[model samples]
Target: EDALYQKLYASLKNRELATKDRTERNSMFARRYPSHAQEESKKQHDHFSLKAAQSDASVEASRLRRQQHFTELASIMKSSNESRINSASERARHHFATVQGEREGKWSNTRQRFDEIRSREQEQRDQIAEMRIIHSNELSFRGTKNSGSISPTSTLRAQTPGSISYFSNNDDETAKTGAVADRLISRILKAANSGKHRRPSEVGSVFESSNCVSSLNTSPSREKPREIDDNATDKTQI
Candidate 1:
């Protein structure tokens, strides 16, 4: 409060001093000049005052124009900055969309390839299963055939007990024939169970069996007549 009062007093004191100086100068000029001359000087002062007022108006106009120009420049700079920001944002958005599209396309292609591979794998599994089933069925069929062939021979032997009389006189020939039949049956069973082609030895064995059968059919049997003892019969009568 005191400083404000001091500043006010200083401004009033400056104003009073300026007024006194103006009054003294005016009084001195009044004393030096006649009435008409004073009137002429007042006219000149008015004219100079008018000229100074005009100059002040021109300076104010120039300052206003400079301020208006600065305001326009600021507005233009702000608009340019906004436009640049908008363009950059648009470009970023477009780039993001493009990258996403490429990623999605890659993912779709990978999924398609995966599906194809899975389908092929499933097909392969089905084929392998089918082949296994076929192999099992073939093995079972071969086993059934072997059993049927062996069953007939066994049934025949069981049904014809009296047929042994044909070879009763030749025990060795009967034994040889039985052993050959057993060997041939065993070899056939082995070939069937193995599920493979027959070897050369097995084929030769088949020919051997055929030859034995042929020889047996063509050869004649040797038989001896029985002799009676008369002394033993006569002792039994006595």
Candidate 2:
């Protein structure tokens, strides 16, 4: 019995030790599993943060590029506007110069025309003065010629061709008296033929008694009456 009891106690002690060892191993396995899981979670969080940072940097770069492009475009537009303005100014200057040249040309033409008109007026005035001088000279010459040839002595000389003197009777006076007597005789003959009964003695008495015959015969004894010849008398009567 002593031997059997000793064996039983040894068996009980060995079983207790085995149980303590198994408990220690289980505690160690639990601690190691929790530590590994914590490490994996930290790694995942770091990857997500890095991707977010990269995305932010890309967005900033795109914004900067857009701003630079806009700045360059504005500068180009300003340069184009300045060029257009300069071209317009140059055109305006050229137009003004053309207008000034035309005005000067017109002024020159007007001055030339005025000078020509003045010259023509002066020529006309000279011609009128010359004409007046010529007219005055002609009138003076005509007055002098008319005054020189109308004297009393010139008139008496112009009439001297027809004067005649009769002592018994000049040829012109005898011709005129004979013509009167012949005309009376022809009248008396015509009266006798017509049975009016006038005699030749009666006709002579009527002729001698005429007042016109007595006056013609009794003219101034110093100056005789002028008798016109037959041809000259016809011309004068005409």
Candidate 3:
């Protein structure tokens, strides 16, 4: 009985030692390797971090794209505005040039018309001056001789080889006629020189004076008196 008790106690002690060693070995392995639940939690954390980083990158890229689009739009708008302004400026210049050209053309035409009228007036004045000179010379020539009675009121005689005298038997009538002729001639000359037009009444008076002088020239006249011719022959004989 004593042997059996000893054997039984030994057996119990061995079993306890064996159980303690096995428990210590299990603790060591647990410390050396992580649990499945802990690894899964760590992987989830890493995945969340990567997803957040990717989202940030996407947002930055979107911001860049939007900025580029805005810049391009601004450039296009600026170009369009400049083109419109240039077009407007060009149109304005063209309109101004057209208007100015038309005005110049009108002014040139007006100037040409004015020059034509002035030239025509000048030509008329020149014709009048020539006519006056011719009439004056004719009047001097027609006054040079007289013998037979022309009219009861007037006579013409030689004053010198180159000159003549004309007078009326009535002194008042002669003076009046002479004064009228001189006044008419002076007025006509003044009007021509001053570029003034004469009234029809005044022109008619001048024509009347000319007709009177022409009538005097047309009247019968002897070449010389008979007494003067006889004296001239006697002088030649002497």
Candidate 4:
């Protein structure tokens, strides 16, 4: 009976020791596996978040660079347009000034030419008036020399040397009749040379009434004919 009691006590003590060892092993496993899994999961989530942030930053920087380039190009175009407009305005102003100066110069020249023409016309009018006055003075100076002042009868008697004493004894009547006969002779000679015809009585009336020889000498005779002398017969005889 003492041996049986000793074996039963030993079995109970072994059972208690085995239960304690099992509880300690389950505690160690829970601490090792669950904490390692939680750390790995946290590391993966942090890496994914860093990559997403880098992509967002790159997209924003590219968009800002494009906006700056467009603004600079627009500013350059505006400056070029302003410069062209200013150059065009300057050219237009210069052209207008040149045209105005030319017009003024032309008007001045025309006015000067008109003044010269008027001066020349006044000088011509003065010259014509001076010529007319000189001609009138010359005509007034020569009016008295052309009128007949000597007596025709005395002039004819003085011109004839010996023919008056043979005509009549009264010298005044002989001078007057000689003057009439001289005038009639001159007129008859002039009419014959000029191809004009006159009556015999018209030529004979200027001579003295008793001078039949003088009347017959002054009048052209109708009964007797004149003979033409031939120069060819006289030259042959010479």
In lDDT terms, which candidate is top? 3
Note the Cα lDDT for every prediction shown. 0.56, 0.52, 0.62, 0.51
lDDT of 1 by residue, 1-238 (tens): 9999999999999999999998888788778876966897899999999999999999999999999999999999999999999999999999999999999999999999999999977766665555455444433322111111111111111113112111222335444444544455455445544544568787666747655445344223422312213332211000
| Candidate 4 regions with alpha-carbon error over 4 angstroms | 1-49, 110-238
Output the TM-score of candidate 3: 0.47
* TM-scores of the models, in the order given: 0.38, 0.33, 0.47, 0.29
- Rank list by TM-score: 3, 1, 2, 4
Question: Model 3, 1-238: lDDT tens per residue?
Answer: 9999999999999999999997786566657765954685588899999999999999999999999999999999999999999999999999999999999999999999999999988887775767576446535543233334333434444444223344433445455445545555666677777777778887676757655454333245633322233222111100
Model 3: how far is 12 from its true place, Å? 60
Per-candidate Cα RMSD to the true structure, in Å, reads 19.5, 34.9, 19.6, 30.9
Candidate 3, superposed: residue stretches over 4 Å from native: 1-52, 124-180, 193-202, 209-238
What TM value does model 1 have? 0.38
**Candidate 4 C-alpha lDDT tens digits along 99-196:** 98999899999989998888866665554454344334423332222222222211122113213211222344444444544454455445545544
The CA lDDT at 47 in model 2 is 85
Model 3 C-alpha lDDT versus the unseen true structure: 0.62
| Candidate 4 residue-pair clash tally | 0
> Which model, 2 or 3, shows the larger lDDT?
3
Cα deviation at 40, candidate 3, in Å, is: 8.3
